[model samples]
Target: MYFFLSHLSVCDILISTNVTPKTLQVLLTGRHLLSFSSCHTQLYFFGAFTGTECCLLSVMSYDRYLAICDPLHYSFIMKRHLPQFLATLCWLVGFFVSMIIESFVVALDYCGPNVIDHFFCDLTRLLELSCSDTKMTDICVTIIVSIIGIFQVVFVIVTYICIFTSILQISSITGRQKIFSTCSSHLAVVSTYYGTLIALYVAPSSGHFQTLNKVLSLLNTIITPLLNPIIYSLRNKEIRSAFSKNVLRRLKR
Candidate 1:
């Protein structure tokens, strides 16, 4: 689990690095000027990372389900090489999807009004910028989200249901509580991350809900990524202990 989590931390940091600084700059400087290439570049990386994190979170949920529900076979099932394979799969899935979609996205020209309402170059916002009809690109993204994104979310839900059932089977209240505590933080994080994403993609986007879309995008792009590391590490005793040993010690000096 920690193996998957460390990768998630790295993913979170990468996404945040890609979006946060530029987003803050735009927000603070009140300068929304961004070249077409630069905008799509950010959009690609952001899309890739978002997809990667979706897969990673589902992978994490699988890890937790195995850890809690099948403790006896956990080590055998989640072998050493398995984590590496899963993490790589997550990255590959995300990047490949984005590369395909963004190639199409960039092909479409932006010859008109470029004032993006959202903070960053989001996929949906980018679709709005195209001078030509974006029906194909929009269909592609909607299909990807409907299939891949929804599948990940559903997988997480199924895993947690199994995990919860297993926890309920535990005779000791303390054991059940301990197991619940271990997963509850992750569950909360997953809920927030996936919930916002579902709302963004599943709902029909229009001028009427433009403000709502921006707010949800803000949560997904900036706030959620920032919250992830803090949520996981702060709630985790091992991580907190290590932080105290290394970072806190350095700061104290």
Candidate 2:
């Protein structure tokens, strides 16, 4: 669990760091200025991290599944090397998917009016600036999101369903409560992260809430990262204890 949490924490931090500074620059200056190369670069890393988090969240749910549902076999099933392999795979798959989407974005030529309505460079927002046909780009993104995003969300829901079933079987209330608390933090993050994404991407677009969408996008990219460490630490006793020992103790000393 710590292994997954540590990797996730780093990922959220890196994702926010990649996008937020530039976004703040735009917001503060009221300038939508970004170079062609800068736009593509930001678009690449943003998609990469978003895709990575989707996969990582699913993997974390699977880990929780093993720990909760198959406690007797958790140690054997979730071996020392397994977490590393899964985390590495998430990173690879995430970046690879983003590369494909960014490649499509790069191939397009921006004729003029390069001002993006979005604060940060996004593939969808960048598509608006393209002079060429966007049919292919739209198709590619739809495929990637359907495969990586929606599939992962369903996988996590199924894993948690199974986990809940197993939890119900535990005879002790303490046992049930312990397992619930352990998974609740992850569930909270998953709900907030995926909920905003679905609102942004999967929801119907007949009525476009441009300003609201952008605000939600900022939450997904910025506020979520800032909150994750707090969320995990507060819910996780071991992480809280370790933090107090390492951080608070040093301050006092």
Best by TM-score: 2
TM-score of candidate 1 against the unseen true structure: 0.89
Task: Compute the lDDT of residue 94 as modeled in candidate 2.
Answer: 88
lDDT of 1 at 31: 72
TM values, all candidates: 0.89, 0.90
Predicted candidate 1, C-alpha RMSD: 4.0
Residue-level lDDT tens digits of model 2 in 94-207: 899989988888888889677878778866777877889999888987887788776898899999999999989989999899889989999999999998898878544334
lDDT of 2: 0.86
Clashing pairs in 2: none
How would you encode candidate 1's per-residue C-alpha lDDT over 62-131 as one tens digit per residue?
9999889888999898888999999999999999998988888888887988888777887777778779
